[model samples]
Structures are given as C-alpha cells and as structure tokens.
Target: MSILNPLFEAVAWVIMRIHAWLSVPFGASSGWAWGLSIVILVMLMRLVMVPLFVKQVRSQRKMQAHMPQLQELRKRYKGDKQRLNEETMKFYKENGINPLGGCLPLVAQLPVFWALFNVLRAISDWQPGTTPKYGLTIPVVQSAKDARIFGASLADKFLFPLPHQTLESRLVILAFVLVSAATTYLTMRQSQKRGMMQQGPVDPDNPAANMQKYMMYIAPFFALSGLYWQFGLVIYWVTTNVWTLGQQH
Candidate 1:
C-alpha cells in the first residue's frame, strides 16, 4: 500500500461518516451533502489544529520579539555560514524557540490535503469494472460520483474536457478557483494585519518575517492550480482558506 493509504483511509472514513449523517436530510446523492462533507472536514481539521495554530501564533510573537538577537547573530557570523547555522540552532535550543513551529498548522494539514486530493482523484477515476479504494462500496462510490455542487461534478476539473465535463462544470470550477484564490489573499492579508497590530512594523532583516511577506505575494497564485485540481479538492482549498480568514478575524 502507498504511504498515504492510511491517511486516505482516515480522511475517507471521516468523509463517509459525514456524508452518511447528512444523507438522510439531503438525500444519499445530494451534492450539498458531499460538498458539505469536504467543507466540514476542513473545519474539523482546523478545529483539531487549534492548539497548534495558537502555538504557531505564539511562536511567531516570540520570534518577532527575538528579532534583535537574531539580527545580531546574523551579523556576528556573517562570513561563517556553517558557524551561523550552528549558532542559530544553538540559540533556538537555548531559548526553547522553534523557528519552524510557526509552520506546524499548515504543515500538519498537508497530509490530509493530499490524501483528500487523491481520494477525490480515485473517485473521479473510478469505473464500472474497477474496484474502489478506501473500503468504499460501489453504491457509495457511485453516489459520490453523482453528487454535484453548484452544478459542478465534484470529480470534474477545469483541465478536463469534452464528454467528461459540461460547460456548467467548468464555470463552477472556475468560480471555485477564483474564490479560492481570493480567499487565500484575504486570509494572508488578514494575518498580516493581525501580525502588524500585535508586533508593530515588521522587521525586514528577520528571515521569518521576510518569508511571510514573500508568501503573501506568492501563495494566492497557487490557488490557480485549481484549474487542474478536482472540484472536490478545490472545495477543500476554498473552505480551508475561508476558515483561516474567519479564524484569524
């Protein structure tokens, strides 16, 4: 089995459970049921990461507060790359500072993100003679395939064509891409605003601070990849981003 099989199974189990719970009211094949399952999954994952998120925010504050020391280290060892690396790590260890801790929430969510992507990809590729992965029954898989959100098939992608997808599907997927990208930008902006408010003006010399600024300008463009991503995965992206905005707000 692939390394991600476990994650796929876990994520798939959650989606199946949510879908089954919603199936009664929304019907077994309702797109809203399936779509909401993905959205809710994102929400659940974020909820579970609350502690990590809080730690990330707190870590950022700590890192910001130590910018002067970090800058001094950088200057002190400007010509010794190896020594700088060693000292930076030593300093972090001494201070209980994990420079990478701020990345925990996003990094933690990556496996689930890719697993959900592959799960939807598997569903999209499922065929009459093919066996389903993730312990999904044929009927359940069929119902999932039939589920539509905003007139777009969850399995469809903007890059897919012709007999495989409808114009409406393309439109809905494009809308999702745009919305995802927009939410991504807003989320970053909101976080930047909060950071500035909490920490005062950003220090340009701080590597972490610089990285944050760079991502604000670059990360939203990644949402455009939704053009090639499954509609269901795009839903996850949009929901996660929207959650970030609301959570940050």
Candidate 2:
C-alpha cells in the first residue's frame, strides 16, 4: 500500500551497490563515491528516458509549427468555448500529436525523484545495527553518515547546517546553491529564447506567454528550496542540471 517503501528499497539497493563497487577504488573517502553514485544514477535515469525526451522535443517542434493554425482556431471559435476545445482536439488527433507529451518527462521523473529522496533520508536516519529491506548494510550506513565532500558531510543542508559546520562546509554549500540556481536559470532562459526566436517574440499580454515567463523566473527558486535537501542530493541535482543544459543545447 505504500509506494515510498518499495521505491526507497529499490533505489537504496542500487545506490548501495554503486557505493560498494566504487569503494574498491576510493575507500574511506567513499563520500565522493556516494556522491558520484548519485550522479551515475541520474545519468542512468536520463539515459533510460532518452526516448521519451526525444518524443517531447519532437512534440514541441510540431506544436510550434502548428501555432499559427492553433491561433486561427482560437479566433474562429472565440464565441464558443466548447467548439474551440472540440476543434483543438480534432486538430491534434489529425496531426498525430499529443499536446501533453511535452509534460511526460517531468511527470515521469516524479516517482524516481521521490525514490531518491527516500533513499537518502533512510540512510541519514539510519540507527546502529539496523538494516532495512534495502540492501545497505550497517557499515554502509555509518560510512554514509560520515561521508564528506570537500569537508562537508553529504547529509548536511545549507539551510540546516550541522552544529559544528566548518567554513569549508559553508563554502561548499554556497557553491552548490549558486551553481544549481545558475544552471536552472540558464537552461530555462535558453529554452525561452529559442521559443521566442521560433515564434517571433511572445506577446507580453498573451496569457500563455505570461505564464511561460513566470515559470522561467519561478522555477529557478527550486534551487534555493533545495537547500533543505542533503548535500549529496544537491550534488546529484547539480550534475543533473549540468547534464540537462548539455542535453538542451
């Protein structure tokens, strides 16, 4: 009945396996190993989703191509909301396009995102000699608790600094926050710019355009919000954002 339990167990097993494999090369400093394992997890997830991403890109292009027709439909049915909806659906059907396809990638990622969160939370909350259904051993959990990247514990958050947080931890947290925000903003800005270039600049008063502009600005705030997440998750996020930027390019 609990989705989180199963997802957490699956993700934890994969993470622990990755950590174990990497530990051979990087022993006591397995914090970096764990951090990089998250990066690899992101890469693996993205790779698996590549086909869907392609569909999303193609859907956007098709939608952009039909923008003029859609506008015409809107004007033609300005007097009848029901007719407009019917016509829009008919048009999409005829074109072999699903307008909602653009959202598939984001929607699909939510479960995996939560799974990753649960896995990290489980590790952070682990008690001595206690092992969950996930394959992570007691020693693994202990090592994860002590895992540090650039002298900052992987479990520490920028907003909730550890009592003995050092200067290095603060600096590293700052760096991660800035990079995450910058990457998010840049990626969204680039997409907006491309859309503008293709669509000849969105009208400032257009409701849809206004919404897109708002999203462009508001979405980057997630990076600030992510400051509540563990530093390891932050590293995963930065890596994912960087990969997204490259993919978008």
Candidate 3:
C-alpha cells in the first residue's frame, strides 16, 4: 500500500467515529446532524488554515502591487534566466513576501480533501457483511445499512433521467452542484478581478499574465467536475467555497 493509505484510513476512521457520536447525540437519520458534521469539519479545517490563507492573499496583493517593479527587473535581466530567478527571489525576500505563501492553503487542503473522499466513500459503500479488517469499527454499521441523506442515497446518476432518483433528491443534488460550481467560479473571478484591479492594467505583451487569466476561467470547469463523483464531496466543497466567499467579502 502507498504511504498515504494509512493517513486516509485514519481520517476515515475519525470521520466515522465523529458521525457515530453525532448520530447518537442528535439521533440517527437526522440529516441536519450529518450536514452539520460536514460543515463543522470544513469550518475547522478552514479556521486552522486561515493564517496560511491570509499570508497567501497578502503575498498575492504584494505581487500584484509590485508588478511594475517585477516587469522592470525582468527587462533588466533579459537573456539571464538564472539571474532573473535570483533577482525575483531577492525581491520577494526584501519585500517580506514568500512566493510560495499562496500555495500553502492548497497544499494543506490536499489531505483534507482525500480524507473527505474516503469518509464519503465509506458512507456510500456501507454494508453489513464486509469484514472489519481495517480500523473502521463502528457499531452502528449494522444499523446503518442505508446511506440515505434526506431520503436520497449517496449514489448518483451521471446520465439523464437519473435512474432511481426521487424528485426531491434530484433537486437537492442539482441545487448543491449548481451552487458549488457558481460559488467556486464567482469566488475565483472576484479574486482575479481584485488582483487585476490592484495591478492597474495587464500587459497585452505578457504571455504569463494572459495564461494566468485563462487559467482563472478554466479552473472552475475542472472544479465543477467533482459533482460527478459524489454529492457528499460536492456539498463539502460548496460549503467550503461559500465560507471562503463570505470570508473574502
């Protein structure tokens, strides 16, 4: 097994235990309890990473504000790739801006995303006959045969007419996915616009800036594809994205 498998399993175990505890306290089959659990998890993760997010945003703003200086540096160091890199590093150091600061939140979230995926997979694939070889020993496994959240099973139908889909369930999933995609796209667009507005004007001749602009549009499409995977993940992502949107505002 890969090194990450253990970590994934541990997260899954924790999620399961938490779910069990919440179920007991709040009563099983309470959709609110389950939903609240996911929200709480996302909030906790976001709160922990808030410092990183703040640093990233500050660094991005600094970079945007210093674009002119960076451009001048680039022009001065033309034909010297190594020197350009060194100069860029020096600039970041002098300005107290870590070039990698922006990446910290994304990097930190990778494991949480995997953990959520594992937890959702466990919930969707719950069955009684499966031998408990792993650390996932929840006593409610026998009683928790159904993975229905508000009468909708976690199973999804990617095709049209959505087989075995109830009207309410379908609507909930659709709304969740649409909100997820829209919020993600809007948050990214707002961030880009804020950055660009800070930078004054983008250089038409700069391919790098143009490519970054293109990526800002393309990323949401890739992010929205997660709806095809599982609604649980979509819910988690949308919840987090909505939180981010609120925080940014």
Candidate 4:
C-alpha cells in the first residue's frame, strides 16, 4: 500500500533468489539459508555504497580542516542566525565542501533498510501453506514457516514470538537484541573516536559537538527498537553492524 512497496518486493525477490542459489551448496536448514541471504544482501548493499562512504570521509575531513574558521563564524555571528546561515553556505562553497555529504550516504541507505524491513515482516507474518505476496515462492514460504534456528524461527521476534514461544526462542531473541544494541553503540563510539582524532578535541559547548554527543545515544536507541523486528531482520542488523565494526577498526 505504501509507495515503497514495489522496491520492497524487488529487494525481497533478490534475497529469495540468492537464498535458493546458496541452498544448493549448503545443505543447511532453510532458516540458515535465509539468514545467509540477508547477510549477503547487506554486504552487497554496503559494497555498492563504498564510493559514497569515501565521499563522506572526505567531507568530514574537510569539515575538520575548517573547524577553526567555523568556530570563528559562530562567534562572530552569534546572534544573527540568518547571516550565520548565509556565511556558512558561502564558506562551504568556497572550500568545495558539502555540509550534508556525510549524511547523504546514510540517507540513501534508509530506503534499502525500509525495504528489507517490509520484506522480513512479510515473511514473519506468513502462515504455513499460504502464498506470499512478495519475496519467496509458495514452497519457500512454507519452508520458512517451518524453519527454526536454535529453536527460534528466523521470522520470530520478542514482540511477536511464534506460536511455540519456548524458552530457547526467548533466550535467542534476547541475545540478538543485546548484541545488536551493543554493536550499534560501539559503531557510534568508534566513529566518534575517529572524528576526534581527525578534528582535534571537540569543545563540549559547540552546538555541532553537542549534536554529535547526542547522536551517540540516539543511534543505539533506534537500534533497540528492533526488539520488535523479525529475527531475520535482526540477523541483517547484527551482521551489518559487525561489518561496520570491522571496517572502522
């Protein structure tokens, strides 16, 4: 029903095809195959955005280089917000810098995340023997319905445990949530450390510095919202966060 439904369907199709291909060589359970497909999907998505990530790094470095000038501008135009905005834009243009460059890659990835979320939600809600409107084939959906990993279905979630709701499922889901939250926090801390190394020590009073500080908490809080998300999606999140951890390290 949403405008993004078509994109979600396309992403789901790709995931299902990849899972089918991987299943041929890996005689693992269907749940594991589906989980691997999600991991691969995240890797592929990140790979495609490598150039944008590079651009983000460059932009951040440029901002770091201009920090002194930016601070002076803030001091000089402390009261005139309109003039400050104009001067900031001019400064960025003169330096060939994009203020939003670091944000662009993150913004671009949002749709992909949303698409995956919907695709996994569809799988999570599918009943055995029912036809899925997107993603896997009828047989695959049936397999998914019966699939369980460590007694927890890939489609299960803390907010909506499957019909079984066994102790093992509860433990697995809890572990996934904790790991996801921890990785997210680590990623933010790592990014902040790198920024400090490049930009010098941040002055806590600066608005930009304060915003970055706030972001440390905000990102992890958002990650925790995945407690309600499907385990399949949690797998994707955990894998992606791990990739980021390795990449940043």
Candidate 5:
C-alpha cells in the first residue's frame, strides 16, 4: 500500500537479476556471485547518479567563481534589504544558478540507499529454513543464506550471529564492520575538509555545520551499526563509500 513498495520491489528485482546472472558463472552458492552482484549494483547506481553529481559540482564551482560579483551586490545593497533580495533573485534568474542544485543528487540518492538496504535486510534475515517475502524464490533464498565469503555468511551480523555460524565467520563479520566503518569515517573526513576549505566559515548553529561536527564524532562509532546490519549490507556501504572517496579525489 505504501508508495515505497514499488521502489523496494525494483531494488529486489535488480539484485535478483544481477545475482542470477552472476550465479551462472560463479555458482549459486558462491559468495563471489552475490558479492560481485552487490558491487556491480553499486557501480551501476553510481554511474546513473554521475550526471547529477557533475551538475552539482559544476554549480558549486560556478557559484565560487561568481563570489566577487555577489559580494559587490551585497555591498551596494547593504542598507536596503528589500532591494538586496530583489537583486539576488534577478541575479539568479539571469545566471541560471539554482541554489538548490547541490541538494538534488543527495535527495535522489536517499531512496536508492533505503531500497537497497531493505532488499539486503530481507535476504540477510532469511536463514536456511526461513522464507522471505517480496517474491524471492527458494533457490535465491538458499543461495543467499548459504553464500559465504572468507568463511563468513553474508547473512551474518557482527554482534549477534546465528548459533550455526562459526567463530571464524563471526570474526570476519567483526572485521568487515570495523573496516567498513573506518573507511566511511575516513571518507567523511575527507569530504568535511574539502567542504570547509571551499565554503569558509559558517555560523556555529548552522544545521550543516552542526551535522558535520556530529558525524565527525559518530563516524567511527558507526561500526556499532553492524549489530543490526548484515555482512551484505556492509559490503554495499563500504563499496559506496570507497566510490565516493574516489570521486572526491
């Protein structure tokens, strides 16, 4: 009944298709098949998002380039707030500069992230004897539950692995969460440094500034999320963070 149901179905369908194609070559139970499917899915999504990212970057660079003119306008209209607002609107209209450009890509990305997480969660929640909703087949469910990378089931969580999973697999899950969390923190740090350099100072109470600060402190602790996230979802998070890091460079 929810509008998001379609998006969730689309995400599951894409993952299912990718896994089917990969399973043929790597074998249905092979972790490589599922892992590669997830990796490839991220690449595909990011590829589609590239144009939006490019546009955002271009818009930011353009704004930076025109800072001097904006400063001049501010100076000219210092005492006249109404005129300043009108002139700002005119400037934006003439220059085709969209103040909201930076938000479009981020906004577009949220649903994709959410849907992917849901699909992965559904698979991870499926154990050998359990069934998943969303029309996932028996073979699909079996393969996902059985798939193992480095002795660790993609369905395994770091904090509370199923009793059937081995200690070695538990260790691997721990490592995946730790590594993924570290990588994410590093990526965010890089972004924060870059943004600070580009945007200069801002008010302490600004939501964006506060968020940057909040995430900086919490980024390392993000590994705790592994308590709930499946190893497969960890793969998605780490891969996407790595992709974002590369883009920043």
Candidate 6:
C-alpha cells in the first residue's frame, strides 16, 4: 500500500462519519459540518504524533546541553572536515542523541498531511448533478464536479465568496490566508528562539544554521501560497502550527 493510504483511509472514514452525523441535524447544505470535520481531523493527527513530539523535545534538550563540547570538537577538527564529521557522529552516538530527532515529528507527519490534502481536494472536486457517493467514497474516479462551502464552491474560489464570485468569500479567504501565514511565522520564530536558548547561539558560519535560517523565511511563503490551493488545508496547517507553538512553550 502507498505510504498515505492508511492515513487517507483513516481520515476519510472519520470525516465521512462526521459529515454524515452533521448532515442528519443540519442537512448536507450546512457547511459547518465540513468545517468541523477538518478541525477534528487535525486534532486527531496531532494527538497521534504527540509521543514522537515528546521524544524529539527530549533529544533536542540533550543535544543542547552538550553544545559546548560539540563546538570544541568542531574547532579541534576544523582543518580535517571528514575527521570532524566522524568525531561529531561518534559524539552524537555516545550521547544517544539524534540531531535529526528535532525533525522526526514533521517527517512522520508528511504522509498524513498528504492524505488529508488529497481527501479535501477530492471533496472540492465533487460536482453537481453527479450521483454523490456516500460515506468515505473517494472522489477521483469521477470527472468535473463542484463542491461548495457555504455560498462558495470549492472549485473556483481561491479564498472565499467562492467560485461564482462574491466579495464575502474573497475577503474570508484572504483573511484566513493572512492569519495562517502570520501564525505559521510566529510558530517558527518561537521554535527557533527556544532552540537557540537551549542550544546557544549557532555558529554564524555553520552551514546547517544558515540553511535553517533560509528555511525560516522560505517556508512561510510556500505555506501562504498553499491557501490558493485549498483553504481548508491551510487551516489545518495553521492549527497544527499553533499547537506546536503551544507545545514548545
């Protein structure tokens, strides 16, 4: 099976049930159900990843505590790049720290993220006059369908008043997109700040630190642009970022 298949099936099952439950009380036209489903999906994923997140945090703390020693080793081996790498790796092994542990939560989450992205994209593509499949039915087999959120159809609108064109949808989308981007940046800033506090000032000349700084700026742009692709997914990411920020604190 594909890496994302399990996550796709799990989210599809849960969200479909949620859609059904909401449909009973508010009817299918009530877009609130869809919104709630997305929120719940994000929550579930975060909960499942919590353990990995905790481990990552612990590993980061250990690495930070050893930063002084690591720096000395770097200076001692500066002229021998390969020896420096070997020494650094040996130190990390002896200390039982995986520097990459800081990224484990995110690495583990990619499959789930893609799964939900595809799921939401499918829902957005559902069309009118088509026999709508019920309860966890995947949307790819069909052609040219449109799904709506409130007055906005998922197919056309990048932000909101949706596809047919309304100022309201456009404003809503813009507002959410800005909020998402800002929140994401704030989250990254907080993480970097905390990491720096724990690890001390990274070597200005360090390639890894420079790469991280570059990502700090570049990532938000990619995240913000995603708002055009699917507003719901943007919300999910924003929510997750907020959660991560809170966890760090």
**Between candidates 1 and 5, the TM-score winner:** 1
1 versus 6: better lDDT goes to: 1
User: Looking at model 4, how many pairs of residues clash?
Assistant: 0
* TM-score computed on alpha carbons, candidate 1: 0.91
Model 4 pairs in collision = none
Q: Please give the ranking of all candidate structures by lDDT, highest first, separated by commas.
A: 1, 2, 4, 5, 3, 6
Clashing pairs in 5: none
Report model 6's TM-score to 2 decimal places.
Answer: 0.80
Number of the top-ranking candidate, with TM-score as the measure = 1
Instruction: List, residue by residue over 94-140, the lDDT tens digit for candidate 2.
Output: 99879899888778777877888776777777777667446667777
Q: Write the per-residue lDDT of candidate 6 for residues 1-249, one digit (tens) a residue.
A: 466566677766877776667767655545566666667777887898999999998987897788888878978998999999999999999989898998988898787678777766656655645543323453321311233455443334463324466765566566666777777778777878877776678788666666877777777777667556565666667777777778877
| Clashes found in each candidate (C-alpha, N, C closer than 3 A) | 0, 0, 0, 0, 0, 8
Candidate 6: RMSD to truth: 4.1
Q: What is the lDDT of candidate 5?
A: 0.79
Q: Where does the lowest 10-residue lDDT sum fall in candidate 4? A: 26-35
Of candidates 6 and 5, the better by lDDT: 5
In candidate 4, stretches whose alpha carbon ends up further than 4 angstroms from where it belongs are 128-130
Residue-level lDDT tens digits of model 3 in 34-112: 6666677788789989998888888888877778888888889878989989998999889877768778887898798
Two-way lDDT contest, 4 vs 5, winner: 4
Question: Lowest-lDDT window of 10 residues in candidate 3?
Answer: 153-162
Scored by Cα lDDT, where does model 4 land? Answer: 0.81
Order by TM-score, highest first: 1, 4, 2, 6, 3, 5
Instruction: Name the runs in model 3 displaced over 4 angstroms.
Output: 17-21, 24-26, 76-96, 132-134, 138-147, 155-171
Off by over 4 Å in 6: 1-6, 23-27, 127-167, 200-203, 206-211
List the candidate 1 regions with Cα displacement exceeding 4 Å: 78-80, 204-207
Candidate 4 lDDT at 57 equals 82
